[model samples]
Target: MKIERTQTGVRMEKRLLKVLKALAEHQDRTLGDLLEGIVLHAFEGRAAFGDETLQVIRQLKAVYGLELTARDSHRLEEAGDDR
Candidate 1:
């Protein structure tokens, strides 16, 4: 397989890093490979969600008494509009 290099940075908790490292070792793959797979999968299907879909998620969160910070709520709203 051919390998390419790119520069990027992400901030994650130490525990999460440990988990990722364990998974990568168990799978005998590089951490970069695993993360690329995850990110690609997340972007594979739709460009954006419609208003109805966004509303449903918000309603479900509310019904379950789940609270998102103002910033998180705004980010979700923005994600639905991102294409």
Candidate 2:
């Protein structure tokens, strides 16, 4: 097997770590590769959550009796609409 190495560290909750490990194993990827992809995606300014995602978050907030700021509401509305 080829060995790839990099120096980096990120702290995640233990439960999140377990889930990541399981997903990596299921996909036949090393944890490092899985994490690298995620980091790269975020660095590339990809939306980790899109329209449906924002809707879900808004729904959850509503269910918990939370209110969004005007800016947040505008952002969510923008996210919902196709540009």
Candidate 3:
């Protein structure tokens, strides 16, 4: 199936973005493509990556210093936000 894509500004944490970009490069995919696949999988309540891919993600996270986890979802505050 062919899907149309749109360009928009999306803000993300610096280290997490670095890890995501590196992972996309490692898998020879565009960052947008990777994010689309991950979101599609999540929509279906499916796991986006297998053990090997997860291992790669772990390494990338370590290299980029992205320590955020699922538990941190919905709890993130902007860098300058004091609330």
Lowest lDDT sum, 10 consecutive residues, model 2, at 70-79
The digit string of per-residue lDDT tens for model 3 on 1-83 reads 88798998999999999999999999999999999999999999999999999999999999988899999989999989988
Superior by TM-score: candidate 1 or candidate 3? 3
Candidate 2 residue-wise lDDT, 2-82, digit = tens? 878878787644444665566566558899887877787789988645577457546555554455453664454333557
For candidate 1, what is the TM-score? 0.47
Clashing pairs in 2: none
**TM-scores, all models, native as reference:** 0.47, 0.46, 0.95
Instruction: List ranges where model 1 is wrong by over 4 Å.
Output: 1-3, 45-83
Over 1-83, each residue of candidate 1 has an lDDT whose tens digit, in order, gives 69788978876544445655555565587998867765776698643335774565455555545565536643544334555
lDDT of 1: 0.59
Model 2 misplaced stretches (Cα beyond 4 Å): 1-4, 7-10, 47-83
> Highest TM-score among the candidates is held by which one?
3
What TM-score would you give candidate 3 relative to the actual structure? 0.95
By summed lDDT, which 10 consecutive residues of candidate 1 come out lowest? 70-79
Superposition error at 24 for model 3 (Å):
0.3
Q: Kindly indicate the candidate among 2 and 3 with the higher lDDT.
A: 3
